[model samples]
Target: MQETSVTKRFNELFDKLEHCDEDEQRQKIEEMNEMINEMDEEEFEYVFTTELFNKIHEMIEDKKISLENAILLLKYIGYYKVLKGIRINGFNESSLEEKFKEIIYDENEKKDEDKNEIIFVDICECYFMLNNQFSSDMYPICAPCLLNVASSKEKKEEAQKKVEVALLALSNSSTVNV
Candidate 1:
């Protein structure tokens, strides 16, 4: 998988760290090593992409990326694939089923806090849209979208920011909200 390249690159960086005694470099290497050791290729790719989406969303919110371009970026990343008519892979048919079940179970035992329904709705719509466009409808909106949507509204500066967050949330593979 492509993630192996990421791991290998990290290893090369770690080797180079030996030439320097900086605590920060060592700490970064240790963190990277730990992540590489703990996660498989699929998980690493999912997490990496999710983190990148969040960072990009942050840039958009900060006005580093224009709203029109942000929407364009969303299209480039496959958000509009549903409208284009793509099939989504079903969770039950994927290896992520067990992990999904575990996460749902944990969430079910937790208390619900008052949250913004609009953001949630937007996220759900975005998920469905993307699922129908890029993958298959069997794909459910995952946890990351739900969490990010709920949290992002707290700092929303414009309508476009909310939409961007919703798109970013849709891209994450963590949870699928029914």
Candidate 2:
């Protein structure tokens, strides 16, 4: 199969993201966000495959990319997946689950309340978007962080939004019961 223009553009953007410094990476991410927003469901889904997701996930795990940037990329993808009603394939859910656990359980992140809350909300939203593919174990690992965000008083509106997403995730996970 031949590569589409969208694939070429996305790859170019991702390559820039990989090679750029933090400032450049942020700029590249913004550009990528724009590109994604312009794509329809089929166009967007065609650009992302399981192998591509694994490569991005590896970048996050290897510390080659900042967690915030990585999560930003993922949240965009996850949001589109939900919006398009598409399912992800070929990605290893177990590996993602473990990484999410590490992020949620990290003491350093926990110490920074604002950052921690943002991470938790992004992650919960991602999980909610990918609800069909998640393992039962995901609920247990994510529940504590979600609960923390739900009870947080500092960012009431955002917290409430996250809480609703968390509840949706938990509600979906209950049907899996695996």
Which structure among the candidates has the greatest TM-score? 2
Quantify all predictions' global Cα lDDT against the true fold. Answer: 0.43, 0.64
Candidate 1 TM-score over all chains jointly: 0.28
lDDT of 2 by residue, 44-146 (tens): 6576666666677777777667878877777677666665666665334435645665665563245565555666766765665554555665566666655
lDDT per residue for candidate 1 within 18-51, as digits (tens), equals 3444454546545554545554535444433433
Q: Which candidate leads in lDDT? A: 2
The regions of model 1 sitting more than 4 angstroms off are 1-7, 11-97, 113-166, 171-178
What lDDT is obtained when candidate 1 is compared to the true structure? 0.43
TM-score of every candidate relative to the true structure: 0.28, 0.71
